[model samples]
Target chain A: SQTIHQWPATLVQPVGSPLSLECTVEGTSNPNLYWYRQAAGRGLQLLFYSVGIGQISSEVPQNLSASRPQDRQFILSSKKLLLSDSGFYLCAWSVLRSEAFFGQGTRLTVV
Target chain B: DQQVKQNSPSLSVQEGRISILNCDYTNSMFDYFLWYKKYPAEGPTFLISISSIKDKNEDGRFTVFLNKSAKHLSLHIVPSQPGDSAVYFCAARRVYGGSQGNLIFGKGTKLSVKP
Candidate 1:
């Protein structure tokens, strides 16, 4: 069974502060990883995706960036958080099967 | 330009009745369509999907139908239960890309099942 793990289930960050969210997958290798954001009671918006290590494709331009350090480890980061950055962030993984599996998600609030 | 659209913002249905959620897209190049169920404060889960080659696909009590000509798709949940009440998102994907099959999601519809 494949599973995804994300840290800091909830967080409160002051404006202009740095941000770092980590995601790791187990029981699978070389799987594609993605980062998505959802506003309150809305759908997901793709931010970035990676097909392999050190390779990332961004969908929407934002204050955030993503990296794939290892085969199953993905990280979303920002140098300084903005008020608009507050939202629900989700990480996912998929492969040839094409079914995306999501993480528990991190609820971030910028004050 | 919203490529994917779930026109309904919310829906209510009696428990044990059928719940039909509709979705429409603007692009015909989209070859794969999917439905995802999301709960509050959690990530979205993969519910079901249908390829362009097939009009329908069924899994358990959930069925997905795709109409390429009309650029529409739907998800039907039979005997809707309280557990089925959540935000459903319609997603589409293409087979060719570094992001192959990486879904482009719709705005979503909230389904409420009343007992």
Candidate 2:
């Protein structure tokens, strides 16, 4: 079975601190990966998506970026966290033309 | 502008009654639509989907209706139960290539099924 893992489940960082959130998938190859962020009581916003290693498409421009270093590893990073950057970050994977499977999600609080 | 829109931010329904959630889209290229259910603090789960070619699709008590001409879609849950309380999101598949694409999601509606 395919599974996605997102680390740190929760994080609290002061404003201007660096941020790194990791997500990985197992039991699949060359799957499409995506990053989404949801504000409290709001809909999700697409952050970035990657179809293959070293290829990324950013949806909403912001203070964040994504990189797929390996086939199944995707990392979301921010050089300096901002107060507006606090939200729930989710990592998802899917096959061609299929529904996505999501990780548990990480809740980041920028204090 | 947001391609997909869900105007209602929240809804309240009594248990054993019916609950309806609505969504609208602006893109005509969207041929496939889906509904996802998300609990608090958890990732959204796939609930149901309907293709543009089909007017409706149903899974048990859950049904999705698509009105392609109006660019609108809706999800209906009959005999709504307490377990049905969650956030419902509407998504449209954006196909970039033959095998590469992703879904564009609406703002989502929070359903409160009260006992």
Which structure among the candidates has the greatest DockQ? 2
lDDT of each: 0.92, 0.93
Interface RMSD of 2: 1.3
Interface RMSD of each: 1.6, 1.3
Candidate 1 per-residue C-alpha lDDT over A29-101 given as tens digits, one digit per residue, 9 for 90 to 100: 9999999999875579999999899999999898999999999999999999999999999999998647899
**True C-alpha contacts between chains kept, each model in order:** 0.74, 0.74
Which clashing pairs does model 2 show? none
User: For each candidate, what's the DockQ?
Assistant: 0.72, 0.75
Candidate 1 lDDT, B31-55, residue by residue in tens: 8888999999999988998888999
Model 2, A35-58: lDDT tens digits are: 999997568898999999999999
**lDDT value, residue B44 of candidate 2:** 91
Best by lDDT: 2
